[model samples]
Each structure stands twice: as structure tokens, then as C-alpha cells.
Target: MSLETIDLSVTIGDKQILNNMTIKLERGEVLILMGPNGSGKTTLAFALLGHPKYQINKGKIILDNNDITDYPTYQRALMGLGLAFQNPVEIPGLRLSMLLNAIQMKKSGSSFDISSIDPKLIIWARNKTRELGLQPSFLEREVNVGFSGGEKKRSEMLQILTMDPKYIILDEPDSGLDVDGIKLIGETIDSLRSAGKGILIITHHAEITKFVSPDKVMIMSKGKIVDEGGIELIKKIEEYGYKDYEGVQ
Candidate 1:
């Protein structure tokens, strides 16, 4: 009934990026993963989503009591797991609407004529874009092409809304955003959490935490979770910094 990583260890080629990591993300809760650079936060996100580059040396990924350690990326998505990348890739020829339509088909497990697709779905996507403060014309443009930092993040949000996965992983979602952009993204995340979705957000900054309160905050260092606590932990990191936790478990 939950997405859990048990004793997870990930390696890329000869280098080990994550070591004996274990965590659980439950339904209707928000978990924030925070760490300095190279602490394996993004690596954990990639491994959880079955990214090929992150080799799971040991441990299991269970989603709703189903072991998905061997599942492929697309299969994980089909199982209601979604990941929003820190740096979303730009597809020059793929229009936003086209990508959303493809996601809808994948979610429904069936394909119909483009014209026969549900009009309400299209309207929903449009409304999501508008709600995120994006222009309607963005639906016609190529995905992530010529998008500003905030626009790119909003685009990722649009995809997340369209997919409607059971569990969501967002990596550095607040990076490169201005004040207003951060506020908008924070509100969007708040709405998602209120909707009872399991969410794991990765970030180094504490600004976003001001808007969206997480149920748990985990600090990572050198591929291990160094410390875990509530809001007090975030305040400690902001004041004392991560120097004391550099290599300590």
C-alpha cells in the first residue's frame, strides 16, 4: 500500500552513488529529501524510477506491495509512479498537447483515434496550464523548448497532472525559479499533497519549505541518510550547515 525502498544501494559503473539506503513514502504524505550537492538525492530519485544508469546493487523497490525492482521505466510509470526531473529534456518536435495525449493513452492502456479522444481531457490540460500561470499558447509549443526556468517547471507540473500517478517524485523542483515562480510551484505542490498523493520532493534550499510543510525531512550525505526529523532539522541545517554531517552516518 506504499512505495518503499529497502536497503537500496545504487552504483553507476565502477562508482557507488547510494549505499544501503532505505526509505518509505506513504499515501497522502509529503517527504522532503535535502542534501548538499553529490549527496545522492537525485541518484535515489533516478533509481526509484528504474533509470538504467543507476544500477541497484542491492535492495528492493516495492510499490503498493508489488516488487518493481526489475520493472522498466515505462512499466514503473504504468504502475502509478511518476518522476519529474531536475533538468527536463527538451523535445523539439513534440508538442505539449501531443505529449499529454500520449501520456493519457498510456494511463488508460488503450489507443483511440486522435479525434475520438476525450475532449474533457484536453480541456483539463489546458486548465492546468492556466492554473500554473502558463499561457494557453504553451500547449501548442514544443515541450520545454524555449521555456523559461519557471515555465519549464510548470510544464513538468502539467505532465504530472495529466498522468495522475499514485506516487510522485520531484527532483529540485524549485531550482532556478524566482520568488513568484517558487510561490506558484509551492502552491501547486500543496494542492497535490492535499489531493492525497504520496510525494517526495528533493531540494537543497529551504525556501520552498516555507510554503509546503513536509511530514518528514531527510538529510543525505555521501550516499547515506545522515539525519531525519521534522521542521527542526531544516532549521538546524540552515543555521549550522551540513559540514558536521559530511561523512557521518
Candidate 2:
């Protein structure tokens, strides 16, 4: 089973952002997508997750063997797809604890009933917060509200851990993180990879590669994958930049 995009093309209004792009992510593997700015990396991530704004002008998104190109965002989540946004939104009044509980219920296919949840789940969440180096009290705060950049990344990890999705799409998870924060995020990603989850990481700066070894790397330009290779491709890009691949098809 795999998360596969076949000949995918996307547009926003009249302008095209992705053009005949295709990629595959299998379970128990990590695929890193790197590109210069405006290369449509984020657009591909959004299209995979069924973002309404990214109109799929062509191609299909396959989850396992199911064609999910037309699935709603919530449906995709239920099909074991998860995305950690680059800029997580702040919900002023919604507590993090509440959100986690909701996600747990959705994953379990159970009716929403906070009163029926086991006490152990609450304990488990608190333990996760501490393990991620977050304060136990942070779980009580509104989701991402007033969180620092590092805190926001950690918070997103908290959700991913709790949900335990089959495939995860992380958009620039290393951005805005300090050295220690990057280590923490990298460790979290390693743990998930060890658990046999498929991961797709999109980044402009390849800093996270130092911590987590990606199985394959793809470079994008003009919304298409220009080149793909093993980890060595990352090093090449780091040294020479995307100049040589600017208009490659």
C-alpha cells in the first residue's frame, strides 16, 4: 500500500502551480522534497491533502488502492492521512486537550463523549507533552495560541503522536526552530519512522537531513519534479544549489 500521486497538476485561479507531477510514498519510508522558493512544494502537499484552494486540474491521489482525488479533507484524515501545517492556526478558545480527545475519538470511530474516555488516555497525553519537552500545563492552553515558533512545532508533533496516522506530510517543520528544537523535531520524526509510518517532508533548507536520513530525495522546479536520487542528491543541492535544475522537466 502506498500514497501515490499520478500525473498530478494543480492550479490556483488562472495560474498553474504544479504541472504533471507524480510521486509515490510507501509505508516505512521517508521521502524528502526540496526546492527553491515558489517551486510548488507546498502546493503539492496541499493537493495531496485535498485543500479546497488547490484545484486539481489533472491526475489522481491514491491512498493504498483507493482513488481519493475527490475526497474531502476530513475524509482524507479518516483514511489515515495527516498533515502538520507550516503555520499552524491558533484557535483562541479551544484547548489542546480538547482537540486531542476529538482526534482520538475520530480515529477510534467512536462517538464523541469526553466523559467516557479512560483516565489513562489523559495520562498518556500528559506524558507525551513532557517527553516532547513541553510543560504539562501547555496542554491546557488553547491550541497554538501564543505559542513560540518552537512551541508550535512541538505542538504539531503532539498531535501527530496522538493520532498515529499512516502517512504524515510535514511542511518545513524545521523552519523557525532553534538548534535544540530541531533536535527534538528530528527525534520525533525518527521515532515515527521507526514505527513504520510513511513520511513526506518538504523543506527549502536541508538542515533536518543531518538528523533524519531520508531514503530518497526529489528536487522540484516550476512545480514539477526535476530530479530524484538517493541522499547524495541532497548534498549536491546543498553545494551547487538548484541553478542547474531550474527549467528541467
Candidate 1 error regions (>4 Å): 112-117
Residue 51, candidate 1: alpha-carbon lDDT: 89
lDDT digits (tens) for residues 1-249 of candidate 2: 799999999998889999988899999899999999888988898899999999999999999999999999999999999999988999999889988998998888988886665567789999999988799899889999999988898899899888889999999888989887788888788878898999999987677887888988999999999999988998898899988996677
Error of 1 at 37 (Å): 0.5
**What value of lDDT does candidate 1 attain over all alpha carbons?**
0.89
What is the lDDT, from 0 to 100, of the residue 180 in candidate 1? 79
Across 1-249, the per-residue lDDT of candidate 1 in tens digits comes to 689999999999989999998899998889999899988999999999998999999999999999999999999999999999999999999888888888898788887445555678778887888888898789989999999887898899889989999999999889988887788888888888899899999987788987899999999999998888897888888899998897697
Q: Backbone clash tally for model 2?
A: 0
Q: What are the TM-scores, per candidate, against the unseen true structure? A: 0.96, 0.96
lDDT scores of the candidates, listed in order: 0.89, 0.90
Residue 153 lDDT, candidate 1, scale 0-100: 88
